[model samples]
Target: MAKKNKIGEYLYCITTKKDAPKEFNIKGMEDSDIRVMFYRDLAAIVSKAPLKEYEPTEENVEKHKTVALHILKDHTVLPVALGMVFKKMGILTSTMGRVYFVLKKSLNLIDNKIELGVKVILPKNFEESNNGKSIEELREECKTEFAKKLDGIAVESKEGKLFSDRLALNMSFLVDRNNIDKFSDILGKLDDKYNDLKVQYTGPWPPYNFVDVRIMSRGK
Candidate 1:
């Protein structure tokens, strides 16, 4: 909550550059400006929101992601945790200054890297090729094929939880920005090969799963 003297900044993430997209603007909880606060070559993408007592409501969560997505379109961003606020701007500045090099190193680690998601769902009673194999058998084959395709292309990959009984595959891949089109092409081929199942693909999102940087200020 904002008192007469205490208002805080909601940090969305840290970007490699200061030239964030002015075209894509997002309003904070108090309908304030979401802009970059700089520290040398680093920039903290933030907006105004109440601190300590802040709740991660659906609206607030979406606002955080919206800002990150926009800035991520052209920059390498290290996403800060949600609901982070600094009572005094000095604390944030000093924190960023203290860890400036660490932040920059993280930015460089994720440079030109983006995350891609894939989910595959199969029918509970699904059958395999004309050979009459089981669903599990076919799913494993599909997994291997996809991995082989991305072996040298994608930088790294991690498996995710299979949310439902019918969900055969849920995973994320760290793909180079330059190879997105190539990644898409590989996905297309896999999709064609497994036409009977449901495959959902998403992102080019700021490697949220890959880069792990969180700003913990003592102000709260």
Candidate 2:
């Protein structure tokens, strides 16, 4: 008989400490599952099950959010995207070793810091008007005008770069942990001004997008 394909489990990258909690009763889709492993300054919270049980169904994907929310309570975690895996323990260990260094550096830069995601969504009518005007005219007149406005807000808010889009702007700010409330207040003011645009913000999360890992060797 052909070997059954094992479902690769998802892993969470977490910070290490002497007092790090050993056991976490993370609520899973079907049942309560305990996180199983911890490495240097990183934890791989995983549970194994038949492929069918954790298929990439819409329901299963939503369940993963529960896992993330529960884990975030105690540890700063870089959530590994869904469907991450390795063929064996050796590969997993090697991968973790490389990831550990990158995460360590990011943690140093972001110690006691949080990542806040800010996305400004523009109205559908604004997006549809792109073809009506000459590209250069639109670029100079509308895009640049809006970008300058966003930049002023970014400067005043003292947040990160102001990313420009067709009608929206997306920005990720690395703010001190203590200043999150103040940051939210600033965002509230921006929301008041741009009442037509939708301003969505999320998190006080670990700086996942800021960490970049380049693994040179694949140790067998």
* Number of the top lDDT candidate: 1
All candidates: TM-score: 0.86, 0.64
- CA lDDT of every candidate: 0.77, 0.55
Look at candidate 1 and tell me the lDDT of residue 94. Answer: 92
Model 2 scores worst on lDDT over the 10 consecutive residues at 151-160
Q: Please provide, for model 2 over 118-216, each residue's C-alpha lDDT reduced to its tens digit, 9 standing for 90 to 100.
A: 776665546433345532354344334444544443322223344445434555666666677777877777678656567788876555456533332
RMSD of each: 3.0, 6.0
Best by TM-score: 1
Error of 2 at 190 (Å): 1.0
Would you give me the overall lDDT of model 2?
0.55
Candidate 1 shows a clash count of 0
